[model samples]
Target chain A: MREKILKAIEKNSRIDLKELAIMLGEEEINVVNEIAAMEAEGIICGYHTLIDWEKTSIEKVSALIEVRVTPQRGQGFDTIAERIYKYPEVNSVYLISGGYDLLVSLEGKSLKEVSNFVSDKLSTLDTVLSTATHFILKKYKDHGTVLAKKYVDERLKMTP
Target chain B: MRNPLSNKITTIKPSGIRKFFDIVSEMEDAISLGVGEPDFDTPWHIRDEGIYSLEKGKTFYTSNAGLKELRQEICNYYGRKQGVVYNPMTETLVTVGGSEGIDLALRCMLNPGDEVIIPTPCYVSYEPCTVMADGVPVILPLKNENQFRLTPEELEGAITEKTKILILAFPNNPTGAIMEKSDLEALVPIIEKHDLMVISDEIYSELSYKSKHVSICSLPGMKERTIVINGFSKAYAMTGWRLGYALGPELVIKQMIKLHQFAIMCAPTTSQYAAIEALKNGDDDVVEMTEAYNQRRRFLMNEFKEMNLPCFEPFGAFYVFPCIKEFGMTSEEFALKFLEEEKVAVVPGTAFGDCGEGFLRISYAYSIDDLKVAIGRLKDFVEKLRAEK
Candidate 1:
């Protein structure tokens, strides 16, 4: 039931509780309680809309920064990851494998703003050694959804 | 001008869905819950395999029985999933689609005047295919009370001295009915006693909701007499890829391959290559799609219950056969009026067969958002009809 609920709401978090219950063939009260428990247990962390900011009038630039950081005497990559992720501009922080120790993704108003943050803020950090930043030019797909033309049903209205 | 068609072809009635299709096509801005195919595009990985095959210049006519690798994969799939074994070299024949396999099987097995017992409401091709094969079609109208599964008694009564084949399609279309192992077990004795052959179309096998789909051929002594037809269309959302296959005794399969060699030569080479990939690594895709379909199925069933509409709970396929008998209208009348009034198109039950007259075959292949809007309109339409009554 936990997995089922997560799978159902994973694609559309805005699914109505009543409809979700019906879709899962479970009682409404059970569904409500189960979701509440899941939320409290931190199984469901948060819900956010998948937005294509490029379509909007506002200016936005995003970059993925791979940061190599030295581990402190006692504290490891987690301490440094927390320090980087605490910034408001950082959308995601991950301890990635291979050449990089941490991958931090951030959004800014312009490429210069993003680059400045990398050089001035990220590079100045005590544990930070080197950083490689890749700015995203276009998004063909995001969050498992195609960001281009909307899908139109091309199937005939009726068929055998 | 003289007729360009053959007499036998002329005698077969046009598909009922075809007529409804014409009417619905003219109605602009109508929301339809009437499609018989999956709404999902072919999974990307499988499509990528087809593209890769093309890039590698693997474009050539495969053997009439299809690529040996594909045949081996199909056999492996059935063996792994259904516990049914077949020889890849001799017992498997891939064709244009499950539709082609159905026609091919009928053409190969039926002699002139041999009777083919077909239970309705089923996919619309069996009767016509039987006719085209010069075999008499015996329509066995399944009862809604029976949940549309054919009973042993029903099978025994339908068989006649000339009855040579029983076309079994379950996880059925239009009705969404499935015959369980016990259901198939009960019918096996009767079939063997009557010396009947079976063409089991398990195209919708992956879509069964209540339990794992039980193929009739898996039962003891059933495989040698059964031609199990399945394909990538329904399971892998590869309908447009036009790939399907048959597994059975080498003798029957050899005949199907012979006819296919002359008629189709081979299914699309790209589709065959893609299907090999689908069989090898497509289980997760099938599970994901099936879960999606099952969620929508539960949603529709609950909606019907809330609307006070009587419908048998269907465990297979993406359709719900809801009885609209309380409205005191034929299924066609209800469907046409629903389309005209609400601008939501649903296939009339009579489109499947006369036994489907009081019901409507509402497909759950669309998204829940679409289903919610369509069902909202249906609630209004049903209420309006009740008020008129």
Candidate 2:
């Protein structure tokens, strides 16, 4: 039941408990209780909407910054990863497994704003050694929705 | 429509369902629940297989029984999903949609004057196909009390000395009623007693909501006597692919293949290839599509309850047949008035059969947003009708 509820919610976050109950052949109260339990247990951390932000009347810039950090004797990469992820501009941070130790994504108002964050703020951190920032040109897809192109519905008006 | 037709064919009634589509197509702003198909396009991966096949130049006709691998996939699919077993080599033959399978079965099995018991309300093609095959179509009017299931009594009542076939359109269209295992169990005795063969159209089998669909052929000793028709149209959203198949006794299939060899030759080669992929990997797609339909089902069910419209909860297919008898208008009259007043089109129940006269079939295959608007329009129409009385 937990897996099924999560699966439905994963595909569509906006589905209500009543409709979920009908889809799963469970009672409304049961589904409601299960979802509440999941939320309380942190099994469901959050319900995020998948938006085609490009469709809106806003221009945004995003950059991916790779950071090489010196490992503190006791804390290793965890302490540095937490500090980087805590920033408001940092949408995501990961302890990557390649040439770079950490991969951080930053969203900003403009390319200059992103560069300022990297040069002035990110480069000044005590543990960081070097940083490489790459700005995204255009997003073709985001959160499973195609963002760069419009999807036209081609179904016919009538069929037998 | 050409000169090579018989007078019998000329007199056959045109479908009220298609007539409604003509009106819907002419109007720019009308939102129709009249089309009896899923609004979703065939999932991309399935379509990609067809595209891949065509790109590979797979345009030649396959064997009269269809590609062996596709036939095996169909057998394995039914076996895995519904516990149905058929010989892929000898007991299955792919045709064009379930429509062609139904027609082929009727043509191969019916002698002139043979009686076929067809339960109503049903999809529009049943009677016409029976007439084209020179069989007598005996209409078995189903009642609302019975939830449109064919009872043992109804079966016995419809049988005559000439009765040769019983057409079971379970998970029935327009009504959205399905016969559970027990309901099917009840009819086995009467069917066995009458020694009648069965033609079961399960095109919408994958759309059952609350329970898994059970094949009538899966009953004890019935597989030998049932011709099961199923296709990619309703389940996989591959309607235009023109691929369907028949699973039955070896003797029956052999005959069907013989007729098909001279007629269709085989289902479109590319569709058969695509269907192989559909059968092999389409379970997830069906589940996803079913989930969408279930959401709309709950919304419509809840709205109908609130509006006092008296709809029997249908757990199969994508339609809700709500009784409109209280409005004191025939189903056609109600549909026309609704269209003119609200610019929303719903298929009148009578389009399926005359017995469907007091209700309407509203397909829930559209997006929930569209359904909400349509339902809202319906609520207002019904409320105005009540207040005027």
Candidate 3:
């Protein structure tokens, strides 16, 4: 019964407690409580839609940006990074140790807009020392599946 | 001593396509169009050369960068076909497959937090590989309205200061989209202005229809910034042969080769020999096989229309991305139900990315007999689903 519920949740994350109880021949209260426990335990990670973003026409742009930064006096990497992250154009930020100090990734409407953000918004920030931007050209694969290698492996077994 | 499972490895979800394929593998005697490989066998002449090389005991590893002969052949092949040429010794480094070439290219170019722009709905490796390289993968979702081709305006919109590399896979996989020369012309100026590196995977270079495949490297001043990745997999029916090559500036190839040497040593010797043969005499084979795929392509498109699945005709590559959202189920739910009810295995589009949620990628690499059976099963499955309601 637990396995069935888990499998159902894996398939349709947004399944209501009532539906799950009906499918599992269990009480709704019990199913809801189990889901609550799973969420509290972190087993139920997230409920996500397989969004077809094209329908929205939001024109969202995504790019990965490499940033180099120097820590400011009396402030550490996080402090400066926090300031950079506060920008509306910056989507995600991480401080990585390697060829660069802080890695800043952002999205914007145009190349000039993104470039200007770097020059005007990000680079001028107190601790941001340098930024190297690279635009994405094409994607062959994304997420966990090789869209091209769908069933290339004839030997992969079914989820029984 | 310990059960030796690392947290990182355990946490990463397995490939969703592979997961579905695993399910299909358990069924008894189901004809499938689920495979992503070419239906044609590797050309006989190429196989013979590989066999001959083994008979002659050329069994040792080649140089870390791969055999000099294969690189030169690749250079000549690209020049003859795609109007791009790189110094074989300096610019070319043969890899295990286009897959490895992509991994190595990302690893070499990206710093821990660097950003990589990836366009979708696409093949599945770019974003994951970026993450593994400790780089952020920013996805720019392409629309079916544009035939799933990435516009230059879209490319320009996706760049930011932390962007380190752009991976361009064309004569694309799932969508069968190709970037014509005109598209490349539109994209070059932005790339030039940004001083960004372009990794172009043209592994399906020879499989295009309606227009020839265009290499970003063919554009003026673009060669220096572009890394052209190709392999014998799709065109020459050499998927298992496991040979591919990446061509780029010497510096970039050098770093990539260093990573390749440490991690992989060299591509398989037998496969390398087969590739040399493929590079030399595989064009006619590619032409023949592509012709067959095109025929199947037409058949599948008509089937989708007749079945009322609403598919866009693909211009290149072997797969069709058919919109399946009308089924009122997510792509995964539909794929699973279709497999269970009809026993016809197809990949859910959501396996590619979020934008792919409402569609399915149907490969034409299966024989027409198998495709016919699969399509029939799908028709029945849809009818049954409707009837039950």
The C-alpha lDDT values of all candidates are 0.93, 0.89, 0.80
Over the stretch B1-389, how does candidate 1's per-residue lDDT look in tens digits?
98888999989899988877888899888999999999999999999999999999999898888999999999899999889889999999998999999999999999999999999998899999999999999999999999999999999999999999999999999999999989999999999999999999999999999999999899999998999999999999988999999999999989989999999899999999999989989899999899889999999988889999999899999999999998888988999899999999998888778899899999999988899999999999998999998
Runs with alpha carbons beyond 4 Å of true place in candidate 1: B1-3
Candidate 3 regions with alpha-carbon error over 4 angstroms: A1-160, B1-11, B386-389
DockQ, computed on Cα atoms, for candidate 1: 0.86
Per-model TM-score, in order, reads 0.97, 0.93, 0.70
- How do the residues A1-160 of candidate 3 rate in per-residue lDDT, one tens digit apiece? 5666776667567766664574355688888888888889988777765543334776645567887877877877878888889988886798887899877777787777888887888778766677888865444454432333444434223210
Q: For model 2, what is the error of residue B227's alpha carbon versus the real structure, in angstroms, after optimal superposition? A: 0.5
TM-score of 3: 0.70
* Model 1 agreement with the true structure over A1-160: per-residue lDDT tens digits: 8889998788889989998988888899999999999999999999989999988999999999999999987888878889899999999998888988999999999999999999999999999999999999999998888998798999988888
The clash count of every prediction, one per candidate, is: 0, 0, 21
Give the DockQ of candidate 3. 0.05
* Fnat of each prediction, in sequence: 0.91, 0.37, 0.13
What is candidate 3's lDDT per residue for B1-389, written digit by digit as tens? 88799654565566768778778777876656667787666788999999999999999999999998988998998889867778988889999989999999998988988888898877788887888888888899888888888888898899999887887888777778888889789888888888889989998888887778878898899888988888988889888788899999999999999999999999999999888888887777887687667757877776777788887778888888898777799999999888887878888887877888888888888766577788888888877876777
Q: Which candidate would rank higher by lDDT, 1 or 2?
A: 1
lDDT of 3 at B222: 88
